[model samples]
Target chain A: MSGLKGWREIPIGGLILDAGNAEQYKTGSWRTYRPVWDEGKCIHCLFCWIYCPDSAIIVEEGKMKGIDLEHCKGCGICAEECPPKEKAIEMVLEGEGKGV
Target chain B: MGKIVALTGNDAAGTAMVQIKPDVVAAFPITPQTELMHKFADAVADGEVDTEFVLVESEHSAMSAAVGAAAAGARVMTATSANGFALMWEIVYIAASNRLPIVMTLVNRALSAPINIHCDHSDSMGGRDAGWIQIHSENSQEVYDNLIQGVKIAENKDVLLPVMVTSDGFILSHTLERMEILDEEDVHRFVGEYKPAHTLLDVDHPVTFGPLDLPDYYFEHKRQQVLAMEEARRVILEVGKEFEKLSGRGYGFLEEYQMEGAERAIVALGSTAGTVKQVVDALRERGERVGLIKLRVFRPFPKEELLEALREVKVVAIFDRSHSFGSFGGPLFTEVRSVLYGSDISVEVLNYIYGLGGRNISLEEIEGVFSDLQGVIERGGVKERINYLGVRE
Candidate 1:
């Protein structure tokens, strides 16, 4: 009953990506790179959050946060503008069939 | 045999339709194109042309009926002018998008807030982006020939787009001229039968025509329409070649008159092209390096061909009968600038808005346009507002 009853209907939240958090998820070949945030060298300057054209980056508790890749076009403007001691934002190659 | 009988442009179009023998003709009479519908009605009454003539109550209904007839897999033809054409605006776009091979004759007239029934390009210009292949004719002969060729071009399997054969209203529609009429048998052989890829009345096939499309598919359909128009450029030339073989007069997408080695040139379309050419010949007799480029096809505008024709000229004066309000530029002038935006050849382009509201464009006024262009060429440029020739101060 536990496995079969719960399995028949997947949670709606899990079935579809949350629209608000979509910017953190990356999909498609058109997106060449996914933004990676480096926690160690990060400063809470929030320059990346302010400059991301897609508003992909979100800031909470006065700290730099990760991007919602689902809605990000992978334009890399945030990666270029990161103001940490070492670049906190870096672009990572997206895996095949991983992005929408 | 060549006939010397004088006939109006509407008569010429109706005569060509008779000779071509289309399956259906739906029209509402509007000046100055009522004669065309009248002649067709007479022909139908006499049992000369075996075709269905639908006399609709309104121009809107006329175009809608034509669209329906075309959808039923019949070769359809219609004619309207000015306000009458404006009335048909909604269905005109549908006729092209639905890919119905309907051929329409638009006797170009000035649109009215003040109500003027005169020769102007406003009617056609207003509907420029309505997705029809627009062809302008310079004279009655071109009008007659274009109507004949329009059917062949529109029905070509590779290019199934609606076509508009436009001539100057009143000026061309009412003017009488001697034109060569092709033998009826030859025209019949040329146009052939109307065979549609998808038809509304085809019960066996049962295809959905003009269904509601969502945004994703709507864009794809428009893209396909664009591809069809680009394909029409080649189809038009091929059709023109076949027509030349049959009729002995060659027509290009753009006709050049003494353009080679000319220092200055005037660019215009419709019946005014003939008038401009006459003026060019006279000026050339006085050793002026002036020429005329008559644009035959306006929509799917012959850009490369136009630039090629005008590349060597130092100054180009565009004579536009229609104005693009609030843009401070004539429609033709805007298109010309867009065509030569990044090109190395920088010919000085000037816009002269003339002959609007059926005002007579005399030879003197045409010469004045050339004189303005001459001034620009001599002094490198001239400062003048959009010169409206014959506009009462």
Candidate 2:
């Protein structure tokens, strides 16, 4: 993560950046959505807490918890790790104009 | 009998593609090129042709589908323009590298940043290194005829390289003109069924396709592609001969008009060559020994033929539609100079950039190019900067 800023210098020749035409990015449009914990349907599985790539999902006490949006790029790893059949954690679109 | 009908270049290409009866047709619609696909769809729906038409979401996907189909030993066709071609840039290389005989119609348009959807050589010129056999058509008739012949050249067992038949967008693609349409059986016999040397879907004798080659093998693979392109030079001429026998219309790598005893010649490609020829004829009527060389096949460039054609000429003016910025020369001009390097011809070559982003290249502007060439010939060398016709601040 510390060296991630250097990736901007990489050339993706086909990419076009037009300042006049700003793109609209809404949350939850990704085909593979990331999940956030609600604590209401926690079964103490702790599955999502272990599998997060960024380790953004935090589990307090004996139950599962929500994501820390500060570091999460919404890759959906935690949602995929969650074993609960009730599927307590869900991925939803952010409010209009809200991205990620 | 030779009959004529008015049709856009896109429509002409689309009509030819449908008549060819390819096994799979996949393409993403970009302006100018969109009309080609639209016309193709209409033909498919009307049962004018029997083919599997896959409507892909993007040019990248379109090329991917084409590769997939070609790998399955299907005769495939596709099309794109400008940024769309840029999007498929990676796969365009892949198609040629894997020896897939995919025939594509490129409606030459300008790549965008300031956002232009008009005509230029920028699109195909950008993909010049992609290893596809490239042909530049000067009119709707050439576009139609080349689409049929390109398939033959590409699908030849000895030369299994993808072929791109290009014509200027809007200028050639949308302009209606009377052109001869070949009989279906004649085209079918001329092109024949594409029999690939290898295919992915052959379950009985399975072989790997597009494996990640190490450095040692990668160089050889590139060498093979080069050999295939060189083979294309012979295949194109052979196919041109067969097509002439069937259609009674002669075709060549480069078409020269009134070059006999001429001191100066103007060389160009695409629709602008038509205008240049008109200008040359007008000048010739006035006793100016001027001629025009229209390049029909650009890739596997007819270097030897060009040298032979210009061997007696004193001056050559090359009109380029796309400029290689910062190089201070056009792509075609650079290649021409390199080809003529150290040759005993001693002919002076001048570069002229014209019709960028669909700027109208009138007969008068072409005459101006010739006049400039004549001035250079008289002066024994070019004194002014490389001419940029129709450019404004």
lDDT of 1 by residue, B1-393 (tens): 435557899889889888878889988888888888898889999999888998889999988998888878899999899999999999989888888889999998899978888899989999999989999999889999999899989998878889999989878899998878888888888888878866667777655566655452566567777777888999999989998998898877999998979889988989999999889899989988889999999878998899899889998888889999887678988898789889888898888888888888888888888888889888887677466777889
What are the per-residue Cα lDDT tens digits for candidate 2 across B1-393? 446778999999998998798999998889989999999999899999888999889999999999999988899999999999999989999998888889999999988877888999999999889999999999999999999999999988778889999978999898888888987787888888877756667766555566645453566567777778888999999989988998886788999889998889988999888888788888999999989888888898899999988998988988889988999689888888888998878898888888888888888877787788788877877875477888886
- Model 1 misplaced regions, further than 4 Å: A1-100, B1-4
Which residue pairs in candidate 2 collide?
A: none
Docking class of 1: incorrect
The alpha-carbon deviation from the true structure for residue A65 of candidate 2, after best TM-score superposition, in angstroms, is: 42
Question: How accurate locally is residue B228 in candidate 2, as Cα lDDT from 0 to 100?
Answer: 81
Q: Count backbone clashes in candidate 1.
A: 13
Worst 10 residues of 2 chain B by lDDT: B211-220
- TM of chain B vs. native, candidate 1: 0.98
